[model samples]
Target: MSEKEEKHVIPYINRELSWVDFNYRVLEESFRKENPIMERMRFLGITASNLDEFFMVRVAGVEDQVDSHYFMRDLSGYTPAELLLTLSQKIHSFIEKQYSCFTRSVLPALKKSGIRFLKADELNESQKKYISEYFDKILFPVLTPLAVDRSRPFPLLANRSLNIAVRLKGEDESYFAVVQVPGILTRFLNIPSEGGNDYILLENVIIYKLGELFELNEIRSACTFRITRSSDLDIDEDSDDLLIEVQKFLKKRKRGKPVRLELSRGHDYETELFLKEMLEIEDHQIYEIPGPLDLTFCSSFASMPKYEQFCYRPLQPVYPPSDFADCDDIFKAIRERDRMVHHPYESFETVIDFVRTAAEDENVLAIKQTLYRVSGHSPIVAALIRAAENGKQVTVLVELKARFDEENNIMWAKKLEEAGCHVIYGLVGLKTHCKILLVVRRDEDGIRRYVHMATGNYNDSTAKVYTDIGIFTCREPYGG
Candidate 1:
């Protein structure tokens, strides 16, 4: 390598630090004064979600290099350990700024908009009584307290699960126990208020009721904490039944070693020591969050239905092409000329209806598609099932390793297989991220093929929100 290249004098920024800056850009959206308060809150939620994935995949990779003793410096001229230290500093600063934006700008504005998030101490007597009762009646049954000691080892905490580590004083010596906030329960709980928005944090609720959980011991201190574990899937592309292997690894991902620990500040001494020793994490791995352990609850908060006025004006999908609207038969329109549809700007119904029409068309011979990430109740999957049952040859490529969508895709794959569709797990060592659909019809021209292609997934639901381009064509060059 040239000396210039060896010295990394190209003046490029660190990839990891650049990614952290990208997340900060998302956080900056929350600071814009003109944007609606709810939208800003959603932006904050997006940044949090983005950071979670960053730690799971990106940060995990750097940590692996450090663990495996791969000391080679990157093109940016930093060792893995040095890069991690730099990333840690950047992440801490970015997160601090994130919370500052939320608490300073977003929270006060949300209050004016009649949305209120109450802490335990901030609750009125009636509100406190109500919350306490709600906790005893509803949350108590789902709670399990794990005590850490010699015979009874610490429980394996689930990745990203909010938990409260309690320091207790007993007859022998002070010890620590942790209780995970139930995943099934919503993090934000709606409480009765004087006609405006009122809610409580689930962690706060859990904290208030900790005394009941450990009635036998003295409650010295209790604080919320969460951990991010490496969730990157290691797929052996050469393995048989890639679906089964991916499924196997998906289970392992939940138990992957902890990569980042986000502990709510003001942890008791014993609690902090226990987390350090039990998780076997480094000091730099511990992120002392001054605010909430997780900000993902903002997503559900922003989605509250009653106040559309407090959010961005909903943008409706534009009408499909004039040719499709002007022509009675979509197939005839595609065959006559190529067509393009822009989504969020253009309705996805045209695409859905095209498939639906083919399912019912007796002249159609076959249907083929690739599904990566699909909606819960996907109309495309339904139509494919209909086509298969009607004796039309249906071939569907369902990529089972679509990251977080693995379980959902697996379900859809099984359904397609049961419906008699020729379902495949997609090309080995490659994710079928491309969006394509092919249909063959026994027209008067013998066998004619029509294709629908896009730069995005064929998800009708997301089409209303995300911008994408799609085309419908029967061009011989494309079909061939």
Candidate 2:
């Protein structure tokens, strides 16, 4: 390469690799002695699950490019193929370290705090009996076991479905079977233990009773595995009936090709090979997690009521700027002066109250807002409906492409449309990511506009935990 060419080469870390490093920092927090034991465990779980998605969407996309013989290179001068190999190695090492931290460090600390995660073989007979009964009553009815055979084609494994791979043997020959863990049931089932303790994971409970579901004369081996697919929604902007097109695309998301497979490390070699061939995944794509395939189960650690001491102390959200404390009229507060609201630290109720007051106010002319990821049973949606009912002009831009939240947004859009609000399904090509609430009012001077701009969604439930910033203003340029 020429000297000028070498000089122009900027050394930058690939975004994907940098993201893994960021998650490593989160994993490191789990080892901190200062954090509450449960909180540390929560951090570890979050990091692991975050990596899963990163590989599924980001790594999978690069792999696709390499597969297609595309030669595009990144800023670091690494082609897709080169980067995938590098990433796979880096991720393997990172996951190994994460599991070590969890198994070696966190688990012991948790045990000291009297919070225990009982493995499948660790359960006592009484505990086993309780778990078995719970499974029979609650879980057995929901599971579907699919056997791979000449008569039955391989069943479609939906993205992110946790399943059990079973090796079954009949009188004639041996075969493979799959049991999908039901989505309707909780991933972690709390088993009653003495002295306010809890025990269970749906996987272990299922493993204890696999024979009941299979009905096979003999079972060779079974292991838990999960698949993640490329969930990036791609749409042609020029398409007609955008809503119809989006709905069609949403259906395809579930059946998207498996990009990553996570199997328990102890899975038999034959069964692992079978999964690779069946799923059409290369060996490099399979990750052998040491513990449960999904560490998301660790979120259940938050449920132990007796371990309340192993959590962050709760802090009540403060009202913004004390001036609006008694005033039912939000417009009056904005008219007085500009205000800023910090979230999780400041209340989201003020934003809801702003919309609610406008809906109720006779002088308020219209309200316009953008909806991204709103909390379930959103009071904000209800307020907009109420505003429309009061004959105030209401317009809402609902983003239907938010990951894992598309269906909820679609339902909300239909409800908003039915309520006579002018609902827009966001811009043709771009997602309206801005969180904004605009209110128009008629006062003695003239028509005035008030705007609430937020760094986070107007979701009250999340506002209690997610640190975000928002501003309530009626200043000259911003208000106009």
Candidate 3:
């Protein structure tokens, strides 16, 4: 290839940047005053959550290439380091907009609606009393404060967990320590009162009481921060046991390399430098968030039943088509022909019914299914367990490499195995993300097969929100 020809620009938008743009569009919805307040907050939360995963997986990959000295530009024509620098600039701007939308647009609207966010400066005597008591009773015992000095090393921080960085004045020198905000506790705390309702950030409450945690030293300064780590799971299919390999991957993922750091403005400068050097993160990777570190707490607001008036009208999952509406025999309906249901508008019951029907049917011989993710109770999993317990051969490919869902998949896989079903992790070097379910059954004619396939996981809960298409069929091409 000629040098001139090799330097030609590709006529395609970089996918990572494209994805960031998509998330920004979602963030824009929060700026709309006409939209229901809580619903808009959910949009803000979704934006933040999307960015977290974007850094963990997408940005992390680019950084890995740069680290390995692999500078080959993609079709989009940006080298790894160049792309990272561009993405970091875009992200910094995007996050500034998010906080601007929250503080200026959303916060004002929320205040008008009787939801007030009183900061530490605005806390009244009663509010301070409540916060102090709450901290002592709830947060204090769970809080593990790690101080970094010559003798003590910096503690490993979890991916995306919020922490408070504190600078304390020792006898002769100032040092830094971190207090991890308990993830189990709610980030937003409501102060009870009849005059009006108010809430405060959990991190602010801790920052207010840092002296309690570090009584020996004078409190210099403190601010909230969070870090995102690379969370990709590599599957070794060549390994004798794929499930065991996934378990090992899950442990390593928690301690994955730091890809992005979100620090709130106003932390002590020296301590900030201390963290940057200790964590070994580049300048572009550090994000100085203007307001709150995490907006996912806003998404939780959408679930409050009390805020129904401030949210959109609830949408229930619609029933299946008229033909299969009252059908008692799901197997018979599938045997006759193919049936497809559009989820979120229609229902996910058809898929669940197929599995449940097969589980109970004495004529059923075997059930084989690929599970990517499912509901909490997971009727699909329960049905598979029932089938296995009833002496029906059951084979399940549970993809433990499903990002952020490895632990849940691992738990379900063990249950399925204990229930006497054959649970396989999936193909080595590749994640089996395909959603397919097959049930072998005995019919009057001979051995027949039933199949359920979908564009999404068989999670009944998400079916109401995530638009998906699922089909149940007994056709030879699909089921055979």
Candidate 4:
């Protein structure tokens, strides 16, 4: 490469490594003492959630390239295989730091704050008795132990699902089996204790009563493991129907190629070898965690009641915000001036009211919106449905390829269609990510159009956490 060419070689961090670094910044919050303990725990959970997607999409894509023998380097100058190798090393080290923060820092802080997790061996006699009864009544019936033998083969575990790989011993030979920790149940079980908010991990409870699950054989050892699979949808843009194509891919996503495996630390060699072989994963893909398999569980635990002192003071969205404070009518507010609503600080309710009012308004002739992602039981979708039901011309572009939100989007699309709304599944080769809403109405003067444009989704649930800005405008140029 000549000097001129060398200058053109832009020096940039590998995107995969850069993403790991980004997640590390989130993990750094858990290490900070200044932040509230539960808030710090939430940040840790956020990092875990972020890494899960990184592995599923980014890491999985690289593996596909390596499998196809694509040796071309990225802008950062690392080939597919090289990038994967470097990413594995970077992620492994990052994982070590993550567990260190969780076990050494977060757990101790949580204990100080009246939250404590007891191990199986640390349980008192009464607690053990309670656990036994709970297992028999609540767990046993729901749990199905899948045997792993020559005849049976290892089960196809669901992506991100937690399972316990159990080693059992019979009179003549040893056997291996798997019991998936029920996802429907809570990850942490609160138990009766004298001191603090005492709880034990659901997996520990199952591990304690492994013998009951495998009554015919003696239980040797059991360890919890979780797998992150490649979940990126391979959309056939040329397919007959994009909705049906996406639905097909969503089914295939359940059993997509495994990208990362998380196992509990200090497992037997036999169990480790068995898993690696069965999952067809390299050593780099396996992560032996020192603490819990999935820390995302902590995110929900952070919201436990009566622990407000250990969490940040909740910021309530200022209702009837300055933009809409003087005027109750959404249309009048927009007609007066271009109003910008800063979310979380200001309310998302202003935008919701806009659609809702349009639905109810007798003069409103039509409404249009693009939904990329929305909350479960979205109010925006409900308002759109209401608008359509009221005989207003309503057209909604619900992007079905919103990554991890396909199923929810699909469900909302169906509801919108059923409610007599013209629902578009989005463009064939592109995802409609813009957040815009348009309402057409007849004013005292003539026909007019009002629009609400935003930097975020119409998800009211996320409005509390995500800082997004939206503008309400009735400008002639914008309307046209």
Candidate 4 ranges with C-alpha deviation above 4 Å: 1-9, 170-173, 477-480
Give the winner by TM-score: 2 or 4: 4
Over 5-62, each residue of candidate 4 has an lDDT whose tens digit, in order, gives 9888777878788889999998999999999999998988988999899999999999
Considering summed lDDT, which 10 consecutive residues are worst modelled in model 3? 471-480
Best by lDDT: 4
Worst 10 residues of 2 by lDDT: 320-329
**Residue 163 in model 2: shift from native, Å?**
0.9
The whole-model lDDT of each prediction reads: 0.88, 0.83, 0.87, 0.90
Model 3 RMSD in Å is 2.8
Clashing pairs in 3: 237-428
Full ranking by TM-score: 4, 1, 3, 2
Error of 3 at 177 (Å): 1.8
Give the alpha carbon lDDT tens digit for every residue of 248-305 in model 3: 9888988999998888976667877888998898888888988988898999966778
Best by TM-score: 4
Regions of model 3 farther than 4 Å from truth: 1-9, 476-480
